[model samples]
Target: MHKYVKAERERQAQRYRARPHYEQRVNFSVGDYVLRSRVDEKLHANKLRVMWVGPYRVVGSADYYFTVEHLINGRTMDVHPSRLKMYADDSLNVTEELIDHIASQGTLLAVEAIVEYRMNSDMRAYEVKVKWLGLETVEDSWEPLKTMSEDVPQLLLQYATTTSDDVFRRAVTTAIDSKQSQRSTRR
Candidate 1:
C-alpha cells in the first residue's frame, strides 16, 4: 500500500509539471529595437538607476536566442527573449532646429546612419555609416539613421541631471523632422 501511494504521488507530480503555462512569447525581428535589462549591480545598484538600457536593434536571431546591437557600447550582444523588452516605436520626426542642435552639439557623432537609395531603374540598396565625435559623413540614400537615446544631447543632459520628458520629446521631434525635410528636398 505504501509503494502504491508513493507511485500515485509521483504520477500526480509529473502531470502537474507537464502542464504548459501558456505565456505568449514576444517576437523580435531584424532591425526591431529592444531594451535589455542591465544585470550589473554596480551600474544599477538603486531603483532609480535606469532599470532598462537599450533601444538596441535586433541584428540576428535563432530559435530562442537574439543578437542585439548595443548602441551605447557599439557592440552586438546575444540575449534570450526573457531578458528583453520591446522598445516603443516612436516615429522619427523632428524639426530642422533639432537637426541643427544635434549637428552642432555633437550628438550625431555617436550614431550610425543607414542610407537607402534607388537607382534610376528603381533598384534599391542600403549602406551603414558610423558617426563619431568631430567627424561627419555625407550619405545618399533613403534608409534612416538610428542614434542611441543615451547619446542624444538632451537625453544625456537629463540622465546627468534633472529634466523633463517634454524636453526630450521636443528634441527628438525636431531632429526627425529635419531629416525628413532633407530627404524630401533631395527628391
Candidate 2:
C-alpha cells in the first residue's frame, strides 16, 4: 500500500510540472511602463478602434494588483495584471500618436474650477463653464450641470451657494441631493 501511494504522489507531481502554466503572474516592477486594456462597450463593433489606452507608469503593487498612473493626466488606477501589457516604444512620433488617440477617446480630464454658470434653453438644462487643470482659459467649455453634479458635486455645491440667482441655485441643489442619495444607497 505504501509503494502504491508513493507512485501516485510521483505521478501527480509529474502531471503538475507538465501542465500549461496559465495562472502565472505578469510581473511588473515600480517605474515600469505599461498599457491598460480599453474596456468599452463599442470595442468589438468598431474594428479600427484603439483597444489599449495608456502607457501608464507602475507606481506600486500589492498581492494581485498594481497601481499605475497615467503619464498624460496623472490619473491613478489599481489594475489587475492581466489587463496590463508592457509599453516599450521610445519613439517621439509613436508617443504623440498615442496621446492624440487617448484624447480622442474622451479621457477624463481633471476640473480645476467652475468659472461660470448659465441655463441652456435649447437643452433645458443648466450648464457650467468648466476650467480644466493644465489647460488655458481658451480651452474652457460648457458642461451640463447634472453631469457636473456627479463628477464634481462639492465644486458644484460651492459654486451654487456663491450665486444669487434662485433658479440656478435650486437646480444645482436638487442635482447634488439626488446624486448624494444615489451614492448612499449604493453603499
Tens digits of per-residue lDDT, candidate 2, 41-112, equal 644766445468777788899988999987766768999888898876333244677766655665658899
lDDT of 1 by residue, 1-187 (tens): 9999999999998887777754656777787777777555545567544356656678899888899875434567799888888874434343566445434421222334322212233432211223443344542223222233223434333332332446444544555566568779999
- Residue pairs of candidate 1 with colliding backbone atoms: 93-177, 94-173, 94-174, 94-176, 94-177, 95-174, 116-141, 116-142, 116-143
**What TM-score do all the candidates reach, one by one?**
0.36, 0.65
Question: Measured by TM-score, how close is model 1 to the native structure?
Answer: 0.36
Q: TM-score winner among the candidates?
A: 2
The per-model lDDT (C-alpha) reads 0.53, 0.83
lDDT of 1: 0.53
Pick out the ten consecutive residues of candidate 2 with the lowest summed lDDT. Answer: 88-97
What candidate 2 gets wrong by more than 4 Å, as runs, is 1-21, 25-32, 38-51, 59-65, 89-94, 133-136, 178-187
CA deviation > 4 Å runs, candidate 1: 1-26, 43-50, 71-73, 89-187
